[model samples]
Target: MAAGAPRIFVSHLSGIAVFDPAGDQVGRVRDLVVMLRVGQRPPRLLGLVVELATRRRIFLPMTRVTAIQSGQVITTGVLNVRRFEQRPTERLVFGELLDRRVTLTETGEEVSVLDLSVHQLPARREWEIDRVFVRKGRKGSAFRRAKGEALTVEWTAVTGFSLEEQGQGAESLLATFEQLRPADLANVLHHLSPKRRAEVAAALDDDRLADVLEELPEDDQIEILGKLKEERAADVLEAMDPDDAADLLGELPTDDQERLLRLMQPGDAADMRRLMSYEDRTAGGLMTTEPIVLRPDATVADALARVRNADLSPALAAQVYVCRPPDETPTGKYLGTVHFQRLLREPPPSLVSSILDRDLQPLDPEAELPAIAGFFATYDMVAAPVVDEAGSLLGAVTVDDVLDHMLPEDWRETEFHLDEEVATDGS
Candidate 1:
């Protein structure tokens, strides 16, 4: 090892392609194997867990790694074909470190470990933990707020935290990720292996899992869904926005979808069936059945109360639907919508119908993707209601869903250019 070796965050090393000295591809890095040692020093990297083209996983000792850089790891063209197994003393970085909560010894505040920086020990073929990037603030409070820069604490400043020691197992480690936005959490989950992803998914509550599942790619969504027990899967599906759940169900084989739907609450099953009835690219298929609804005579105060629901998406909460009797699905009649902004300007006692957007038309449930896009563009609305031939409100399609459909097929894969700029020498 050379002096002043580059310090790379462990996350940057994850998923980078591995190559042999002859320039032949080996396999991508699955995880780092490390052994914890006593004293003030950090754990030592022992080997690389590599998953080959054959779908077989094997171990490549650190001695076989000739070089490591931003986008690839160079090996000496030698590898052990036998499978990699976890030794009693070793810990997998990707499985164990990324989101573990560790208390800051100085502040006595708990922070989630976001990433770990590791570097080669001076003049030796060994790497040890150096710095840790941790996010401050408690869980639920930070989920919706913008997170500031991570506090990079030297490894020694962290103490008395271990999954086994805390007796929380995966739950304690996953608590750190509880504060991440669903989309951000989905991105991190995408990079993990199937097993690790399932472990984390199991740790999340239904609502959080539903939100994250909606953000993940269809294949990933299906994989994680398959891992859950039937009843738990039903609970997660029911918690998801109906449209998102329907979209996911549409991707699975009919028998599996039917089985899972059977386990769901009847009302939720009915809602999903209604969504599944429409063409995937149509407005009905892309709309959520759970928009804030109100009776025509309801007051601004009532509308405001609906807007306060924490589970409602921002777009869905931005307006309230006014209908005749039966505010639930097949909403008795599509009276009109009252923009939340309009409610603010009206007196609290004023009826919602008084400020309704009478001229704002709803989209037909069968409207095609292009028509839906035009509706959003022409009306300058983040969400629009869907109605049946009889003018009964069915659901509301949000701008996020419309944009999701408008994006290219490989949008999610390209969104994170993990290969382009992962590793860099800290200045």
Candidate 2:
């Protein structure tokens, strides 16, 4: 859902049907998954536990939720079907939070949590528990119908639910490291004991883990992925960039790779299979399957919107590939590219085809790492489209991926020291 979406109570969401973009019922909401913050700050609403028709529950990230209507949750139709497993840092709203007693900060009165309200943050996809609907005093006895005072208070007005500053285990550590960048977090995780590393990895949400995994050494990536349950591992892999995920998958034994691939969405699995087919250092292998693709008829406005997606890396967002029908990867005949800068110069209503950069030769799928690196350097381009022999747009190879392949394998393992004072400094 977009930012400023209406607040929704936990009670109202219970058992609500979740539908896809096509209005087909996919599942029912079972519970909410949230991670408690370090202080009185509201817990981030990670996602929902949705039980499907077969009674298998899966995690539905808030990012995938397009809209939340009364008694209905509409998804973007993209879902990770692996069974939901609670992480060390996650809490279940129904299973653990409801009816629990917490102290109200105002009058120091202990209140029972009847419900909690969550709202999407402005200009972001994040959702947080903003308010608590609670009842003061104990529940009424069965014989005498005694009702306690009911009140709704800000989440900060409650003293419980936050992670303890001195708390033990990964939950507290996660809260402390919540703001760390993926690369920085990977560095921290690399130095931790294997056991502690596993604990922290298991506690991270799929997206966070995926990003960190991409930044970690190959050995650490294998070790951590092996520690997770097969289903959860599959979920994390699904969350990763297609090129990164394929690389990780390639390191696994054939049997293990096939198993995880079987668990992934068919389209995602297809992408993985396609990427795995090319030589590891080739343009096809380094290209990300998902790129900003637009049709000839698309306007500059449409291309700009795709380029604005937060999930895309800077390299990938640098330009968009214009193609024929089948806008997805391995799309119909490749047309040309439209750079982000060019799009800015055109009117919003102008068709992207008018300003296409047709002169630049797209990367060949079989182009070796050396050729890929040279192309980026020669053109001073951050990204280039990969087209097949049939002139179909395959995907886009990014400069970062080219550099990754060209760098020494041990480069990521090089240890660098940070000043103790600077390391501890946070402002």
Candidate 3:
């Protein structure tokens, strides 16, 4: 469901089809995983257990889930096919919570849980079980109740499913900071002790940890990554931006890098290897492998649709690169650029190739930092496409990446006084 959507009963979602952005069926939702809090607080909705066509059930984290509507769940098309292994802290909504006997706080009468309603918190991406559908009756493990009166009550009214204690792990901390931005959350993690940091990192979903890792200092990134399992580390790396992932992989021992690369998807591994082939401060090294690339025949509507993606950074969405046949980097032939503003001004069906800015030269893959900075400054551009010797589009180097490389090496240490805020006694 979209943010601010009405609470959805669990029964409505059971057995629903799950599809990727391309509208291809990936699986069917079998159950949901949630983590119960210490008190009467409603459990946090972690993810869905989706059974793929092969009948292998995998965990589809809420972070990767873009929308839930009438009959299907739409994901960001990023799937981790790893088998779903229930963690110590997780509780299955269907298998465990439903048809269970729980006590009503006021009446002291036992009731059977028929269904639970989950809602996304206002203006936040987090979802939680806010209401419980229950009937006053003797407890039995049956989904249907034919006799007693049934009513939907707030989650706080019932008390039967075991609640986690406050001090055990990172569940409390994660719930407390569920709404934090990646950078702000990174600051929180930086202040934590190594053991606690590892705990919190382990608790965070891959997409979240990936964003936080991008904002963390290189040392902190390496430390937290080192503490994770190799497979998980590879998954987190795959979730990160191609440029950032390549930078992290570059710091590891060659053998360690190779091992992680082997665990990653072949396409992602190739991007990392290609990025690592460039000098650290060069355009090729700084550019993200995934850019908004469209073919010559793509319409303004197509370009606008791609730009609407919430996952893209502002700079990356500022413009789109129009190329020849293969609409992926290294794209067929580096044609030209189509700015978002131009897309807006043109008719929806207008061809993007017709309005391209061909006069502006694309950056050479090996362009140095100073030259890249100069190019941005001279053209007043937020992003510029990078092309290789054979005229293939390598990727686009964004202005943020240029400034990141040009800034002092210790910039992240003092970046917004994170060091002082994280220090003991603020010393």
Off by over 4 Å in 2: 1-167, 415-427
Lowest lDDT block of 10, candidate 2 = 418-427
Task: Tell me the RMSD of model 1 versus the true structure.
Answer: 16.3
Q: Is candidate 1 or candidate 2 better by TM-score?
A: 1
| Cα lDDT of model 2 by residue, 63-91, tens digit | 77889986799987767777787765578
Residue 59 local lDDT, model 1: 78
**Ten consecutive residues with minimal summed lDDT in candidate 3?**
417-426
Cα-based lDDT at residue 390, candidate 2? 98
- Between candidates 1 and 3, the one scoring higher on lDDT is 3
What lDDT tens digits, residue by residue, belong to model 1 across residues 64-180? 677887589998676666777675446888787767777888889888777788788777666777888788765422112336546788887886432222233557546657667
Judge candidate 2 at residue 365 and give its lDDT.
Answer: 95
Off by over 4 Å in 3: 1-168, 415-427
Off by over 4 Å in 1: 1-169, 415-427
